[model samples]
Target: MKRALILAALVLGLGGAGWWYASQRDATGAEADPPTVAVTRGTVERTVLASGVIEAGTLVPVGARVSGQIETLAVELGQKVKAGDLVAVIDSLDQQNEVLKARADLAQIEAQQASNAASIREAELALDRTRQLNRTDLASTQALEAAEATLAVRQAEARALAAQRDRAQVALASAELALERTRITAPVGGTVVAIVTDEGETLNASAETPTIVKIADLERMVVKAEISEADVIRVKPGQTATLTLLGDPSTAFEATLRFVEPAPPGIAQNDAAETTEAVFFNGLLDVENPDGLLRIGMTVQVSILLERASDVLTVPSLVVSRGDGGRSTVRVWDPASRTATEREVRTGIDNAVTVEIVEGLAEGELVVAARDSDTASAAVTMRGRRSVFGF
Candidate 1:
């Protein structure tokens, strides 16, 4: 009888412990239910961010026109220069020798031409005298014909000498022009962006590589911003854009879109495969750097405003849940009891943080962002028991 009583007591204790453990688990789940959100209203902005470099609107790469050794560089990188200013001088000795040879050849041809002219005149006079003598029967017919033939030959030789003189003069002018090219000059009024060739460097202008210097007009600058194909269609010429320098974030320069490239430049040769599928369209923004604050290749951030909306009802994106069949739903809170109710909504123009709610929700209304499922079930069961047991 004592063993029977002990076994019964142990079974009852075990049953009580099992019931307590289940009760504790249910209580823990119930405490986790209520969803919370703070309702507020303010303004939000939509923006696209991209990084790009600052570039001069007018950039010119100066190059040596003639192949020669660089004698001296009058300017260095970042030097301000004016149009027609001499930047560097090449060794003009070879060019000078060429010019002298051309001139000497020209002078020799001119002297020969003078002699040829005098001989032609003398031959013509001889021919006339012979004809007169022949008419009077004082000269032989053969002598008269020989004099005429000499006159014709002398005239042809004079014409040939004149042509040679003209050719020699052209050669001299060409040599002089080539000599002038040895002195490199700035073509436009600007700052020297780079000096490619240093003093004593041998430049081979005939070997297909040509540029020696780079000059840019820095008074005005352009922001060549790349816009993705998706956003490019919305952008157009004359649209207002704001440019912000990378290091300087406190200030922004205002500009207008000057142009949009119809096709990307050098797209076929680009080896970056990730960006290959992203067709980038270029947009030009014109800004005046009057203080000379902008420099070539300086990075800049650009913002182009596409559209705007004013005084619209909006909600936090987390509260707007995507439902079945592509429907957008939201959890609306009851103002009287602070209880959440699922409601279908229409949304538009979402900026990722907040969404524009067109219908089914009003301003200043609280919305639930997902409640703990276990807590919600426990709360529902508690309410059901209270109703059923009349407590």
Candidate 2:
């Protein structure tokens, strides 16, 4: 029996001792079992593993442009708003007072001009009377000239008062604008993600604009994924990606690779010779969130599709062997001759499960995966072909 097994192993070109045992089992029940699969057309995909946090693509902070105490806040956290929506109101008593004071100053200027105009009229009448009296020789020439000079002085005073009124009008306009600033409004349309300040909080805008609320466009969520530098080269814009949140492992969503950052966010300054810090590149992907299931800062597992082939001849990845000089070899099972023949083939993209056969193979042909496990007979079809892994 041992000599017969050796002859069978030599005929099949199976060098493994495990395969010799399987051949014995097949010899007795050759019609019952076979460890071979037919080459078929299928799809294969290669993916790059990554992780990141989900966030809104656009974030807007609602802030106060003027310094004042908050009197009223119209919107709450998570509230949706449109552009120009009134979000908050600051204490505008001071601003209103300024506007009133400016208007009062303008009123005073107008009142003074009224009195000046009346005085100018009286001076003109006196000058005309003086000229008549001088023509009739009843008034002195010096008196007539003095009346003319008084009329000129009154007209200059009226002109000066009118200039003061013009300045007061500009001051009133400025005061009114300051009052408008006290009413805060949303500059963009989005959801109010956060409320930075409560009612009655003092906001100082003299140095910088004080943010009152945070707004975000949550309709589209973006993930800023970090891919290992080793796999970053394979990621590119417009690639396909899928992400699953850490909280819910069962649900997954589709996204499109939007961008790959040119550089790391920031590099640390280090001088250690043996530092083993792992470097990563930033990648961005956008996903639809019409249902709002995704939120900002949510942790997610990401997979980026690097390569894919559809409707191509493929076989189990285990059956393809990698040899020297980047060559690949596979064993073809010929049903008619009942023998194993070694065949070299060109391969394309591959995944953990299958490999794409680009050339040197035809569809519907049997490919050997591995030697059978049972060593009972020459018909070594011990295990099912689909589950067999070829070394």
**In TM-score terms, which candidate is top?**
2
Instruction: Tell me the whole-model lDDT of each prediction, alpha carbons only.
Output: 0.79, 0.87
* Model 2 RMSD vs true structure: 8.7
| Runs off by more than 4 Å, candidate 2 | 1-34, 109-167, 267-276, 335-337, 371-391
In angstroms, how far off is 277's CA in candidate 2? 1.5
Error of 1 at 264 (Å): 4.2
lDDT of 1 by residue, 1-391 (tens): 9967977776675556545445545455532224556445555456555556678988898888888898889998889999999988989898999999999999999898888889988998999999999999999999999998998998898889889989999999999998999999999989988878788998887867577789998989988888887888888887777788878988998877889887765555654424546677778888889999888888899887665456777777777888789699877777577467888888776778887777887777777766335644554455354332132
TM-score of each: 0.70, 0.72
lDDT of 1 at 24: 40
